[model samples]
Each structure stands twice: as C-alpha cells, then as structure tokens.
Target: MRKKIIEFKNFNFKYRVQAEPTLKDINLTIYEGEKVLIVGPSGSGKSTLAHCLNGLVPFYYRGDMSGELKINEQDIRTKNIFELSKIVGTVLQDPDSQFIGLTVGEDIAFKLENYCVEQKKMKEKVEKSARLVDIDEELQSSPYRLSGGQKQRVTLAGVTVDDVKVLLFDEPLASLDPATGKGAMELIDNIQKQDNKTVVIIEHRLEDVLHCDVDRIVVMDNGCIICDTTPDELLSSNKLGVVGVREPLYITALRYAGCDINPEMSPKSVKTLNIENCKSKVKEWFEITTISEKQKKCDTILELQDVSFSYSQEKQILKDVSFKINKGDMVSIVGRNGAGKSTVSKLICGFYKPTSGKILFDGKDIETESIKSRSEKIGFVMQNPNQMISKTKVFDEVAFGLKIRGVDENQITERVHNVLKTCGLYGHRNWPISALSFGQKKRVTIAAILVLNPEVIILDEPTAGQDFKHYTEIMEFLIDLNKKGVTVIMVTHDMHLMLEYTNNVIVLSNGEKIADDSATNILTNNEIIQKANLKETSLHELAKKCNIDNSIEFVNKFIDYDRRVR
Candidate 1:
C-alpha cells in the first residue's frame, strides 16, 4: 500500500465571518507521489479546502477548525505557517500577485536569502531551479517583461526552489491562452515525475487540466466531497454535468451521438480515447444532424479602417488591423495573451487613441469624441471586477450609472432590480460585494453594464474563471440581449465560447488581423488555430477520428444541437 502524505479525518472549518462552515465532514487521503485534481463550481468550498492544506486556513484566514488533519503523519494543527511552507509550496492563480523581485533570478532566490543561505550555494540553487523550469536563459530579465506563460514559469521555478515535497497549484490555467495552458500542464507533469512530488491542482477548468494525467479526481459540491474517483470514471458518469462542471467536449459529443462510454475505452485524454466500438454510431449521428444557414446582417454599426496602435515608438501593439461589426450581432475577438486581443477592445472603447487610423460609429468619425461622450454610446466591462465596482452593495453599484444620469429614484430602483434578476443576482442584490465569490463578482460587474442599456458592450474575458453553469447562464443571457439588438464584442481566450455563442470570430496573431470568418471556419483551420495560439475543438477532432467528412460542418451542427438542447 502507498504511504499517505496528506489526510483529513472528519475535518470541518468555518471562517470567522461566514455564517456556515466552508468545509464540512470531509475525509480525504492523498498518497505519496499521487497526482490529484479537485474541482467544483463557485462557492463549492474548493478554495477553502486548498487553504487548509497550505496552513492558510488557521494562520491567515482565522477560522474555527475541528477534527484531525495531518501532513506527513504529523498533525498540521500543531505546525505554524512557516513549518507548513517547508512541506508544501503553493503557486497562486495569478502569477503577478506572487512575484516580488525585480528579475527572474532574484524572485527565485528570495526564498533562499531569507533562510540566510551562503551566497555561492544560493546561486547554485537558483540556477538549478531556473533550469528545471527552462528559464535559465533569461535570468537577468524582469518577470514583468515576460509573457503570461513565462511569468507562470518564473513563479513555478520560485516555488520549486524550496524543494517542497508537495506542490499545490490554484487555477494554474486561469490567465493562460489555450495552447499555452496545454504546455503548462505538460510541464507540470514532467516536473512531478522528475521530482517524485505529490501534486494537487484546484481548478474549475476540468477539460483543460485533463490534458494531463491524474491518479484521481476529487469532486466537491456544497462543502462536501460528493465523489472521489478516477478521471475515466468521472467522465463516464453524468456527475460532472449535474455538478455544473464541464465534461470534456469530446465526451459530451459522444453522449450526444448516443454512445455508451466505459472506463475500459480510455475516456480521459482525447489522444488515447478509444472510440472504435462507437465510431459507426457517431458517423450515423453526424450524417443525420442538420444545421441551418446563418442569417447575415447588412448594416455595419462599427468599422475600423486600417487602425494602428503603439504604446511607444519602439513597440507597435497593433498594425493595420481592420474589421467591421454588424448591429445586433454577437462577435468574439480571440488570440494569445500578447496577440493584441484586449488592446483591440480598448481601442474600440476609446480607452486608448489609435496611433493611426479611422474609427467610425454609424458612419460618424468619433476621433474627437470625449471618453464621457463615448461612454454614452459604448459600454466596456473591464476584465477585473474590482476596477469597476465602487459601491459596497450590489444595488448601488448597479444603479450608479443611471443615478448619475439624473434618472428618478423610482426608475433607478426598478431598472436595477430588473437587471439584477436577469443576472441571477437578485437574491444578492442587498449583499456586500466583498462577501461574494469571484464568479458572483463577475455577474455583478456584468449586471452593472447591462443596466446602462448601451447599444454595444465590449467585455474582456467575460467568463474567464466561471464554471459551466455560470458560463452558460452569462452566454445565454448575452444571446437574448443580442436577439433584442444589443451587439456584443468579447475579447477572450476561450475557444469553446467562440464556437458555441458567437457567429463571427476575429483571430489576431503577432499584432495583426490574420483571420476574419465564421466561428466554425476559424476553429477548423489548423493553420489559423496554430498561428493564433488557439486549440482546435475536440468535437472537430472526434468527427475526423470517426472518419466523418467535413469536420467543420460537424462542429457547426453540434453547436446548434447543444444550444437547442440547453
């Protein structure tokens, strides 16, 4: 039998501020060198559980704890935060928040310096750790100067330098692009095997994380561990969908085609998935599934004529980028982190003036329009909710826009309440914004924008950290608003979001407009997907693996079927 590295026996913890326990009656054991994944929806106690493992619960969070918790067969409650750190190292969801030093070498060596290690030994350790994460070449470079993927590598190296026995990752792929996220998982697996360390990942992006291998998947819901099983077992059951976590797209596609999936068929990774037994069924279903032609809009509400942008004379963020968005149409802007996706949105919102080019709204040149004047016609929901949220309560934040416009008190109340209901935040209308989870705060921010009732809303990663249920809720709400003639432009890294909701997709690569076409066409094009750092849909791959012709049409029809079924 494998030795247990971490164990929790009837553990329960409650934060001082919370009325109820965050984790209740949990009994879990992780063996040495085992890789495990913990998943759940927002407010499902996953974060609290992770906090308990790293000693953030009793030391930092100030919570009431009961029952037994052990790390390496020692009661963790007897150890302080410093002692816990030596056993397990944590890599936060956002890499920037964890960074402290000026350069890559300093950040990784900061931990050793605190321990009063000799100068020569510290240098050797830092160099070794940097090389372990493949960041040795840029030791002198600033961590801030690196890309999102590189920033994560620096943080990973910083944590691994401590040589902790357990590595805990919190939403590791939260801020990464599709291809970059896949690479991060592979790197993590390689490190785990090379170091023989136990790994625990807390994430809601189940499909993306499953690109790696895990010994077991622990599913938490409503402050409890509802299921603890292998990935194949988890994917074969309906538990993931019922819990509002997304099953892999290919698994969902197999079920949609009426195939019986079993663990023996390797249902976890797409590359190893065995579908020979159900290939005929999938082919027949693809043959019968039909998709209707999409209706195109003629009127262009917004147009960019050869727009170019640069932060400085040295670096041009965007070059001669041009596209048109039709009125009442929903569109997606997609690319890697530095591919100028969010930069394009900022340019459209007039947050940053283009260095060169013409921007027209309804055939009117608004180059001279003030930011306040542009706000009246265009609404931009920033990526971080903390940037936009000003009031403590949800109602005030939602009504602030209308209140400042000289709207009557009665009208503001009615409008804000209606928007709150539409955003699934009606029950929390009076709750403090600080008490809400990240996903709830996201809905609150979107609710504030919807209350303004602008003709066009440009959102940056609207559903970046949201689970499947909230993602579906927000996307379906946007679809309703689109049908009611609200044009939505989203800058996102989620490929599934583009294919599922948006009719038109704009792909950016190296600060240039490389592809402007339908979502299916863009996703199915291997060359375009590679250029933009995007990943192809598993449904497209599934169709091709089953020998179905025209994989593009197969993906299009599947999206339609999914929308209708929902």
Candidate 2:
C-alpha cells in the first residue's frame, strides 16, 4: 500500500488584505514517491497552495485558515515554519531571489550550516548535492553569475541538501529554454527515483513538465480544484482548454487536423506516438486544409550591419552579426541562454555600443544617439516584471511614461485605461502593485510600455512566466499592435510562441547569427535548430509520422488555421 504523505481536508484560506477566500474547501491526498503537477491559469491559487505546503500561508503570509492540513500524518497547525522546512523543501520560480550565499558552494551549505551540521559532513553533503544537480564545477563561482539553468540547479542542490522527503517546485521551467527545461525535469525525475521523494510541481508549462512520468495532474481555477486525474485522462478530455490551460501542441495539432483521438489513448503514448493508426485521417485533413499565402514583406525599418560586440577582449558576445527588421513585422529572436540573444536586443536598444559595427534606425546611424533618444523610437520590456515595474499602483505605473513627458491628465487617463483594458488589467487598475500576482505585474509593465506608442517594441521573454490565457491575451494584443504598423521583436526561448505568432525568426548561437528566415523555415532546418539549441515543435514531428507530403507546408497551414481560429 502507498503511504499518504500529504493531505488537505476541506481547507479554506483568505489573505488578510482580501475580503474573500483565496482557497476554498479543498480536499486532496498525495502519496509518497508520487510526482504530481498542479496547473491553472494566472491567479488560480496554485502558488497559494505551494505556500501552504511550505508553511508560508499562516506564518509568512498572515492569512486566516480553517479546516485541516497535514504532512506526514501530522497536522500543519502543530508545526512551526522551522519544523515544516525540514519536511518540505521549496524551490521558488526565481532562483536568484532564494539565493543567499555569494558563491555556489556557500549557498548550498547555507541551509546545512543553520542546522549546525559538522564541518566535514557539511562539505561532503554540499559537494554531493552539487554533483547531483550537475553543478560541481561551479562551486567556486558566484550563484548570481551562473546561467539560468545553472542557477536553477544550484537551487535544487540547496533544497535536496537536507534530504527532505517531500519537494515543492514553483514554476521551475519558467525561465529556462526548452533543452534546459527538459534537463531540469530529468534531474527532478532522477532525484525522485533515488530518494523516493514526493514531488509537487506548480507550473503553467504543462507540456514540458509532462515529459517526465506524472502520477496525477490537478487542475485548479478560481480557488477551487476542478479536476484531479492522471495525465492520460486529463489530456483526453477537452477540459484543459475550457479552463484556460494550454494542451500540448501536438494534441492541438491533432485536433486541428481533424483526427479523432481514441478515448483510451494515453498522452504518454504520444511521446513515441505512432500515427499509422490515423494516417489516412491526417492526410485527408491536410489535403483539405487551405494554406494561406505568406504576407508581403514591408520596407526595412531597422538594420544591423556587421555588428561585433565583446564585454571584454577575451570574450566576444556577438560576432559580425547582421539582420534587418521590416516595418510592421513580428520577429522572434531565439537561442539558448547566454547564446547572445538578449545581447542582440541590448545592442539594438543602445544599452551597449558595438565593439565594431553600425546600427541603422530609419536609415540613420544610432551609434551617436543617446538612450533617451532611442527610447523615443523603440520600447523595451524586460523578462522580469519586478525590474520594469516602478509605480505603486497599476494605473500610475502604466501612466508613468506619459506623465514624465508632461502629458495632460485627461490624455493620460484615456491612454492608460485603454492600454489597461487591452492588457486585461482594467479591473485592477486601482489595485496596489503588491496585491497583484507575478503574471499580473508583468502585464502592467507591458501596458506601461504600450501606452508610450513607440514605433518598435523589443520584449525579452514576454511570456516567460505567463499562463495560457495571459500568453494568448498578450500575444494577440501584440499582433494587433503589429497590424497598426509597430514592429514587434520578441527575444524568447519558447518555440511554440515563435512558430505560432511570429513570421520571421532570427537564430543566434554563441554570438553569431546562424539563420534569419521564416518561422517555418527556421524550425524545419535541422542544422539551424541544432546550432541554436532549439527544439523542433511536435507539429513538425507529427507531420513526419503521418508521412504527409511537404510536411513543412502542412505544418505551416496548421499554424495559419490555428491563428485564424484563435
């Protein structure tokens, strides 16, 4: 018989600031050695549940709680935060925020030091934990200086150092690239096997998390658990999309291709899915699907000519990179972390002067232009919302740029409100910035930039931590902006976003521009995908499995239809 490790019986919770409850009448049971995924749209109380497990609800958050919650058969009310920490180890979405030690080894040992473990044992445990996460060589390096993937591994090492029986991961894949995310998931899976640990992951990236074997998937909405079922059952149902959760891309493509999936088919089967059973159906659908012709390219709006940049003489970040952005184009800048993707955005935005090269904005050299001058023409939204948000209130934050330019109150109000509505934050316009969730704060920052109405917008991982609903909302709004003649440049690691929304793709690898072409073309080129460390979309694989003629064309048509319907 499986051991029940965590249980919630009719639990309810409400934050001190809110009038209504954030969690309502929840009943759940998680068995030992099980991997469970909790998924929901933004503001769905997923993070709140994680906080409860980590003893952050009543202790840190100061919330009113009722009913019973237990871990290892002990009631949560009987245990203090310090005691709970030994039972449940939490790794936050932002590893940087959780990091305390200056160096990697120090951070991993920080937790052990608090418990006053012997000096020899502490060093042994730290090294062992670091090796488990594949960060042994980075022991002497600063935790803040490591790559996104490495930082996450460091956090994992710290959490596992104590050998806790239950582990909680909050959005572990939010900031990682597809390849790196897969690696993280594999590491977690291995840890669970070796330690028989009960793992709970709260994330919006369902497809990536599903790569590992998941015992159950819990779907939540509006502070309620709507469904709890296995991965096979959950994907077979239509509830995921109805509740604003994103289904896997291949599943979406299968539905788009008019293939009636067998009710009993498991999503696990889809990983090595054999399409021979439905080949004819898929082929017929492809034959009938209308392929939309590509849109005409507009005039070049910005150009980078032989751009070469280096932070130091020993390390070059960009090597003779060159590209052109057309007016009203929705282009994606994609690559692995530290592959110079964000650096390209920085160079274009005038954050750094190229070591040797010239950047042209509307046929004029921007090398001599100041950042303030560049800001007037181009708007940049960073990946982390906290870095971009300034004002205390959502409305004020969105209106900060307009007010700085001496805009009248009436005009500022009109613009701010419209942008808020477009960004889906109109209801929270008057709310305090601190009251909002991470995703909501992200929208607020984007709204602040959109109100400025710059000709070009550059966003670094705009949908990094966003759920499906917010991702669609933000992308659709950006698409509308592109239709209005604003050139949109997205620096992202999400291949789905690149394939579905953007028309042009710029592939960067080790400070070099390897390919600049259509999204379909870039995705279809194995050489470019490998060089840039990009994962091919499942749709591409689906087409090949079905043996469809001109698989690229079929995938392209499916994307077109998907966009039109959405």
Candidate 3:
C-alpha cells in the first residue's frame, strides 16, 4: 500500500479577518504518488486547504484552527512553514505574487542558496531545473519582462528546484494559453511518473486536467471534500454539473441530450464519443439564427488601417494590423499568450499610439487623444480584477466611474443599481469589496465599466477564472448590451466563449493579425488554428470522427435538439 502523505482529521478553520469558518470538519487522506485535484468555485476553501498542506494556513494567513493536519507523516502544527518547505513545494496561482528574483536563473537558484549549496553545484542544479520547465533560454532575462506563459514557467521552476517530493499547484494554468496549459500538464505527468512525486493541483479549469493521469480527484466546497473519485468516474457522472462544476463543454452537451453517462453507458472516451450527436445537440441549444442582412450591413464603428507597433527598434510586436469593428458587433480577439491581443485593446483605448497608419473612430483619427479623453468613447476593463477595484463597497465601486464623469447622485445610484443587477451583483451592493470572491470581484470591475455605457466596451480576459454559470451570465449580459447598441471587444483565450457568444473572430500571431473572420470559418481553417495556438473545438473534432463534413448543419441541429430537450 502507498503511504498516506497528507491526513486531515476533523479540521476546521476561520480566517482572522472573518467571523465564519472558511473550512469546516475536513477529513481527507492523500496517498503518496497520487495526483489529486481539489476543485470548487472561488472562495470555497480550495486555496485554504493548499495553504494547510504547505504550512501556510495557520502561519501566514493567521486563521483560527482546530483539529490535526499532517504532511509526510508529520504534524504541520509542530513545524513552521520554513521547516515544512523541505517536504512540499508550492507554485502559487498568481505567478507575479511569488516572484523573488530579478532573473529566471537567479530565481531558480534563490531557494537553493538558502541551503548553502556550493556555487558550482548550485549553477548545475539551477540549469537542470530551468531546463526541466523549459525556461533555460530565459535564465538571464529579467522576470518582469517575461510574458504571462513564461512567468508561469519561471514559478514552476522555482518551486521544483529544491527537489521537494510533494508538488502543489494553485491554478498554474490560470494565466496560460490552452496550448501552454496542456504542455504544462504533460510535463507534470512526466515528472510524477519518473519521480513518484505526490502532486496536488488546485484548479477551476477541469478540461485541462481531465486527460492528465491523475490517481484521484477531490472536489471541495465550503472547505470540505464533496466528492473524491477517479477522473473517468467523475466525467461519467452528472453530479458535478448539477452543483455548477464546470465540466468540459462536450460532456455538458452529452448530459443535456439525455445521454446516460454511467460507467457502461457514458461516452466513455472522448475519442469514442459520437461527436455528431453532441454537436447536433449543441446546435439545437444555441438555436443559432442567421444574422439579418440589415444587421450585417451596419455602419462601421472603428477602423484600423495599416497599424504597426514595435516595442524596440529591432523587435516589432504588431505589424501592419488592420481590421474594422461594426456598430453593435461583439468581436473576440484571440491568440497565444504575448500575441499582442492586449496590445490591440490598448491601441483601441488610446493607451498606445500606433507606429504608423491610422485608427479612425467614427471615421476620424483619434491617435492624439489620451486614455482619459477616450474613456468617453471606450470603456476598458483590465484583466486583473484587483487592479480595477478601488472603492470599499460594491455600490461605491460601480458608481465611481459615473461620479467621475460628472453624473448626479440620482443618476449614479440608478445606473449603478441597474448595472449591478445585470452583472448579478445587486445582492451584494452594500457588501464591502473584501467580502467578495475573485469571481465576484471580476464581475464588479466589469459592472463599473458597464455602467458607463460607452460606445465601445473592451474587456481583457473577461472570463479568465470564472465558472460556467458566471461565464454564461456575463456573456448573456454582454449580448443584451450589444443589442442595445454597444460594441463589445473581448480579449480572451477561451475558445468556447468565442464560439458560443461572439459574432466575429480576430486571430493574432506574434503580434500580427493572422486571420479575421467568423467563428465558424476560423474553426475550420487548420492553418489559422495552428498560428493562433488553438485547436478545433471538441464539437468539431467529434464531428470529423463521425464523418460529418457539414459542421454548420451539425451544429445547428445539435443546438436545436439540445434546446428542445431542455
């Protein structure tokens, strides 16, 4: 029998800042060499459990706790975090929050230096670990200058350099593109297989980890384990979906079609699942009506002509980018990390002046306008929710933008309340910002911008860590706003969002505009998919396997049927 690496007995904890317990009576056992996933909505004690495993729960977090927590057959209460660090290495959810070194090389060696390793051996170990995570080439590069994907790699390398036997990842895939996230999972699998390491991954994105060869998945809610089962069983059961756990879109579609997902009747393998049936159901659910000729012929809102931008004299980030966003059009900008998707948003918001060519808003060049001046025309919601939040109360946060624009108190209150309810935050209007979860904060930031009712609304990574329920709500709200004559531009890596919500797609590669077309066209073009670091949707993949060449018809049928059944 494998060793029991982590054991929690009747454990309960409450943060010093709060009166209620975040975790309650958690009983769990993590065996050695087991890859366990702890999942739930934000603020569900997933991170709290991770902190407990790493000895940060009662130490750094200053929380009241009762009962026993053990790691590596040792009680964590008996040791400080520094002593427990030798047993478990943690890669935080936010890479930027844990960076301790100026360069990648130095950061990897930072942990080793604490042990007083000889300089020569330290160099060899640092190089080996850097190569392990594929960041060797970035050894001397400043960590601050690295892209989101590269920053994630640096954090992974930093955690593993100490040769810790237990590895804990707190949403490591949050900032990565899908391709990068998949690669990271493969690397993790390889490491566990070769080294027999115990891996505990905390993530809300279930699709990325579904195929990873994990031994067990422990689902958490309200600081307690709700479900503990294998990946195959978890995927086959609809219980997770009922509780709002965001399973893969394919699985969700299958469940909607009245397909029994039991061990014997479940689609079983993603490869073996009849994708045509699933797509037929998805199309039925979507009820995708063709755009009216008049709607398609709407007037242009913004035009980009021969726009080019370069960060340095030798390195150009964007080259000759050109596109047009029509009035009331919901457009998605998608690409790999660091592909200049965010740069296009900045240019649209007047944060950066294009090196050449013109960006015509209402057919007039606004290159000279400041970000503040352009706020009247465009509303920009940043990627990090923490950066956008400033006021203490939710109502005040949403009203700040309107107040700054010289709106009266009555108008501010009315607009704020309306936008709050639209974003599903009206219930928490009087609540302090500190009381909300990460997902709630995201909605708050969006609500603040949405209340402004700008001509064009631009959101950067609007649904990065949101759950399916929240994703649907946000997209539905945005769709309503678009119908009300607001142009929506979203910078996202979520393929599902692009396919199910947006009307147009813009693919970027190395900061260049590679393809601009409908979502259907982009999905079918293999070359564009490769360039933009995306794969065919699960529905598309399944359709090909079932020999359905007409994806449009398949999708329409699938969505229609799914809707009728629902």
Two-way lDDT contest, 2 vs 3, winner: 2
TM-score of 3: 0.92
**Residue 433 lDDT (model 3):** 98
List model 3 lDDT by residue over 141-202, tens digit each: 99888987788888878888888989999887777777777777888888888778899998
lDDT tens per residue, model 2, 379-467: 99988899988789999999999999999999999999998988889999999999887778888989999999999999988897788
In model 1, which residue pairs have backbone atoms overlapping below 3 Å? none
lDDT of each: 0.90, 0.89, 0.81
Deviation in angstroms for 286 in model 3? 12
Alpha carbon deviation, residue 169, candidate 1 (Å): 1.4
Clashes of each: 0, 0, 14
Q: What TM-score, computed on C-alpha atoms, does each candidate reach?
A: 0.97, 0.98, 0.92
- In terms of lDDT, model 2 sits at 0.89
- Candidate No. with top TM-score: 2
